[model samples]
Target: MAPPQPKAAAKAPAAPKSRVKKAKLGKARNYDLGNGIVRFSKTKMFHKTAKYKFVGKKNPKAPKTKKATIAVKPIGGEKNGGTRTVLLRRRKSFYPTQDKIKTHRHHKCFRKHERNIRPNLTVGTVCILLAGRHAGKRVVLVGVLPSGLLLVTGPFAFNSCPLRRIPQRYVIGTSTKIDLSDFKLPAHLNDAYFKKNKKSAKRSVKRKEGEDIFATKKEKYVPSEQRKTDQKLVDEAVIKAVGKREDKKVLRGYLKAAFGLRSSQFPHRLRF
Candidate 1:
């Protein structure tokens, strides 16, 4: 028996309700096209009209703005030289944001404002080591050098900041400032001070005569024995300044929090 002929699918027009739900609606910006002709478009961005010019009876006179002028020195006379007035050209800046302006010296427009990345590099500033074998290590700012250099230390036994002068560019400065109120370290802290202090500290370690029987003969310390001693002294001052424990791990957490860094960001003991 022949099966009933397949029924043809009926075509149904889209309903108005379905079409309304599927359509997208957005407010478009109105642009001045002159001559009362208004255009509505999604491609055009909305902007407020520029400064209004008052010429009606409500406010008859237009306000006058003062002109800007700057003093300029003659060529090759920057140091101890007389200056002359240079009139600046006033123009309407179409830039929406100040960041769009370029920064340059000796030009019509000068951008004096700059970001000071290392501004927090003051005395007792705790920092994170950014490079070398000790990358990610923490250090405390104990002394500042006159040449804008930093004298930092890790209290080596704790964080490995050796007593050395490093350039400010190397370490990452944190807003967390440490205290050095009672620290009487000399302005010029050198390797000699560390060597001498370490030696004195080793001699101060008291040991009984019979204590050496089982003890292996200690090899001469290469700034090793004194490091612990210096660490103690450094830690004491640091603890006083920061009012918080100077544990390396704790400071690592501080660095992570201050910079909003992830644990995977700085690899521990990274040679880089």
Candidate 2:
């Protein structure tokens, strides 16, 4: 009785309730006209009306019209069976003829994107082989092939790499170039020159009655005499040209040493 009581908290006013209006649908009616004709009318919600007029009788037992057909002869001839009837319309193809033609042209036009070699990559330039069986080997660029590959050689006598064709992308061109004014590649060393001959199947030799087939030792593969002559000719020409240069010894040493990265070395930051 001695403490004053706090007044009751005032109640918040209530929000007004929203009302939604409903649409009323009207009745539909149909009127029958003379000679199998009928008119229909329907009133929809929101005061919208639709009307339709139909012709012909509404009997479910009426026969349907048949499609036109033609008789086609069988491929095996009339002896097996007469002609079979087919619809007049042609069958649709699974794919459009235009799309088929476009696909054929796309495949025919597909070709390797040719990349231009670096400006330093010229005839007589020294390049490092970056891929294939001769990766990391330094070779001399002799010429360019019709297929855009680089024709290079290790002079056979220096690094044992003979005349070969390699893609320009797999080679890193250096600033070094040699004097090849007097040296010229042989005319026979084209793309066809490197074409490998198909070896014939080994013939099974008939042994004598007293002879044992297992006694004969298998011979090791040896390079042909023609290949030896070619290698000798190319090596002699390249070595003679290199011998005339003042830095011949240095160039020989560079080609003999294989390319490699050392610890704390980055290829991008290093000079070729």
What do the candidate models score in CA lDDT, each in turn? 0.60, 0.76
Report, for all candidates in order, the number of backbone clashes.
Answer: 2, 0
Instruction: Name the best candidate (by TM-score).
Output: 2
Per-candidate TM equals 0.36, 0.51
Clashing pairs in 1: 154-161, 179-241
Q: What lDDT tens digits, residue by residue, belong to model 2 across residues 135-253?
A: 89999888876567788889777888878899888999988877776777777777777766575435446687888885544445577787688778767766777888899889889
TM-score of 1: 0.36
For candidate 1, write residues 1-272 as lDDT tens digits. 99899988998987666434556775545755778555743323222432233324384588889655664646555584555656566557686665567865442332333324365677787777766666676777887654445677775546545676667777877666666767877533564443343334223334568676444444354666555566567667765554454665565455333222567776454432
List ranges where model 1 is wrong by over 4 Å. Answer: 1-118, 191-221, 224-229, 244-272
lDDT of 2: 0.76
- Total backbone clashes of candidate 1, pairs 3 or more residues apart or in separate chains: 2
Name the weakest run of 10 consecutive residues (lDDT summed) in model 2.
44-53
| Candidate 1: residue 214 Cα off by (Å) | 39
